[model samples]
Target: MFKSRKNGVNRFAAATATHRQRIQVEHNSVLDSEYPFRLNFYNKPPAMDITIEEFELFALDRLQVLKVVEMAKIRNRSDEDYKKDIQHALDTYLPMKS
Candidate 1:
């Protein structure tokens, strides 16, 4: 697989096909509309059935986004630049759906 580069920085990595079987597993999940979004304070444990691979990806994305913010802070980037960097990270790693 070819990696995407920007400013001579390697941005993309090859992904192993490990999630296919996990995602195809039969599982019953509860989709409570009470928590349609993740930004709110949690009232209880979330009710969802996600594969291990998906969970791992979610965690990694969260860490990546946080890393971008922390790095921007350490670099003392301007507010607009910081926001842009965060937005780019979010858009690339996690997309919001309505």
Candidate 2:
């Protein structure tokens, strides 16, 4: 409950100034081993510039791909069949290569 001389500010709060200071950080400084999904941590969402339409498309595409994988598993397909089915779904929805 200490007081400042000049403006009568809380001296106790000033004494704990370091605790109130925001931490200076560089992006991606945290180690991957310490944080799985380093880019997608709960505190840090990915920075993306996309239209709402594009975002919905990406979300729907991922859902479709996941659904395919789940269906293949429920069918109890052979390992090769499962792999091929998932691969085909990924190719259609989340294509990485031409």
Candidate 3:
């Protein structure tokens, strides 16, 4: 289970302060244009170039997996049933993974 709102707020404030320090370092050390492109504040690398077809395929694969996970959680399915359902989903959506 997650923490209460008060704890969440305190954690958020601490994280934001830490982020501001890193931003200040970046701003002082490099020109605006010189800073490397990143996807998020944690400095995650940007995703490699992907074609529309590839993107669609990846989305479909993820959706299939997520749907199975949701069904298992929502229905409170037995472990064996969940495993079989997820395996079937994987076989249908991501045959290459095997």
Q: Among these predicted structures, which one has the highest TM-score? A: 2
The lDDT of each candidate is 0.78, 0.84, 0.74
Instruction: Judging by lDDT against the true structure, name the best candidate.
Output: 2
Candidate 1 lDDT, tens digit per residue, 8-71? 7333432344333454534324334565553657766567889999999999999999999999
Q: Which stretches of candidate 3 lie over 4 Å from their true place?
A: 1-50
Candidate 2, residues 56-95: lDDT per residue as tens digits?
9999999999999999999999999999999999999999
lDDT of 2: 0.84
RMSD of candidates 1 onward, in order: 17.5, 12.9, 9.3
Of candidate 1, the 10-residue stretch with the lowest lDDT total is 10-19
In model 3, what is the error at residue 10, expressed in angstroms? 15
Evaluate candidate 1 by giving its C-alpha RMSD to the native, one decimal: 17.5
Candidate number with the higher lDDT (1 or 2): 2
Residue 17 alpha-carbon offset, candidate 1, angstroms: 57
lDDT-best of 1 and 3: 1
